[model samples]
Target: MRLVIARCSVDYAGRLTAHLPSAPRLILIKADGSVSIHADDRAYKPLNWMSPPCTLKEGDGDVWTVVNKAGEKLIITMEEVLHDSSHELGVDPGLIKDGVEAHLQELLADRIETLGDGWTLIRREYPTAIGPVDILCRDADGGTVAVELKRRGEIDGVEQLTRYLELLNRDPHLAPVKGIFAAQEIKPQARVLATDRGIGCVVLDYDALRGIEDDKLRLF
Candidate 1:
């Protein structure tokens, strides 16, 4: 990874035109041939970025231009470079999620019939263009079901499940897929949203799901 700190201005020319005036900023040229300009805000989101499958061209002086196959251009003009350095960070091992959500998904998949009588799992992490649905299943009548599992349910979680439904319902084999929002605790607003969208909401008992039959699950 190459990191450059510079006093630079940036311009983006493509679907829309954007510009960032001269200021002290960090420019990142990653090993994947992606380039991004960052300000000291927004946590991890870069102020501007050109993703991979793009080309970076450094011209004479301090100007750099990046272009993509779609003909989009990200132009970085540096008046002065404060620091320039590169580092070789080896391949990452990927994220190892701790035992909550992952564990819940596994538990639910193993005991799929807990959802309802005759309910069966089709796939966990069912693939789609937008992203994977946490659980793909079949209901009592063999209708397709897509479940989005979360540690805590919120309106955002409902919205995520809604997207998966839209994509899954497009496939002929899964055209009539319905969604279930499963979480430990679902917010009232999220429950309402899921209801409004005709999506089922299931409040899971973590302990019971871990195989203790002391408390029961609720479906709304």
Candidate 2:
């Protein structure tokens, strides 16, 4: 059977362009408005995201079952389905989430310096008693900014950032610092808490961060 695949360039917020294919199976977007569809059962065949190819089949429940080259099975929900299929095989979702979060942190560190003439990213792996904060930045105004990011969870991580804030608040050396929590989703409770505390937050959906669907991830 011959599949007619057409490529369309999708410009994502001017940051990236992905080539997407017309077919539903193994659709990947390229920057040149080109799309490629994989004709095989390998989920990541087009992107070559995984070696040995991963297979997707229906599982016991509605969730999809993913089997790697080693015959390891992973059940994934619709939300994580794409990440599971595209990334390294046989890896847990949490681990993948962590990696994504880390990558975001690094990107933020690189871009924060260009947020304006004065704003600058201070450092990564900012140490604290609980654990090392992801990114600590100094804004153009000289106020310290504390940022924490998570891949899977909602703003529940705000609770954890609250601790970092307390520590920084106690230490006068940290400057007039502000807190920012970055995540894929922000829960209502966590949002309220952050608002009440006058903290800033940014939320991005998975697709938006990936710049796949027009950078539609709204962050506030």
Candidate 3:
């Protein structure tokens, strides 16, 4: 990750024309070729950002241009750079990867009934051409459901579930497989997208899931 604090102005030329007046702001350049401009406030959300799969070119002096595949261009003119530094964040295995999310998957598989009455898990990491579906289950009516699990559900997660459903539904045995996007927290946009595409969104309760596991252990 590279961070640059500078007095800069920005102009974006694309579907719509937008401009940021000359001011002191923070510029973030990621390893994936994404660039974002941010003001001092607004927490984590950048004021403007170009996602990855783009190109960046540094021009003579303090000018930089970023362009994406869609022909969108972001021109940044820096009057003065206050500070510039880059840091190696190294590989991120992801948060709560081992304990939280993985355990959630295990608990959900054991307590498939939480999804619906008579729902039973067929398998975890169900295979698909693209990738593995988090869980494959059979509902009360014996219909197959392909579930995608996430720590925090976003639009991309919904898209992934959609893709798995598309592929799984092609199989005769899993024909018409339904999709469920399960996450501890789901964004409003993601929920809307899932509903629009006839997918179900499940907001998981991590603590409750763990408690269920504990209760079963106690009974045993």
| CA RMSD of each candidate after superposition | 8.2, 18.1, 7.2
TM-score of 2: 0.47
Tens-place lDDT per residue, model 2, 1-220, is 1222322221111122333333333343332122334545744434322112356565554444445444544332332223212232232222223567777766667656433467787788787654677788887789898987776434447756766776777678885678987777777767776887687777755554455333336663
Ten-residue stretch with the least lDDT total in model 1? 211-220
Clash pairs, model 3 backbone: none
* TM-score for each predicted model, relative to the true structure: 0.55, 0.47, 0.56
Name the regions of candidate 3 deviating beyond 4 angstroms: 1-97, 213-220
Task: Report residue 110 deviation for candidate 1 (angstroms).
Answer: 0.3
Candidate closer to the true structure by lDDT (higher is better), 1 or 2: 1
Error of 3 at 99 (Å): 2.8
User: Candidate 2: misplaced stretches above 4 Å?
Assistant: 1-97, 113-117, 152-155, 205-220
Clash number for each model: 0, 10, 0
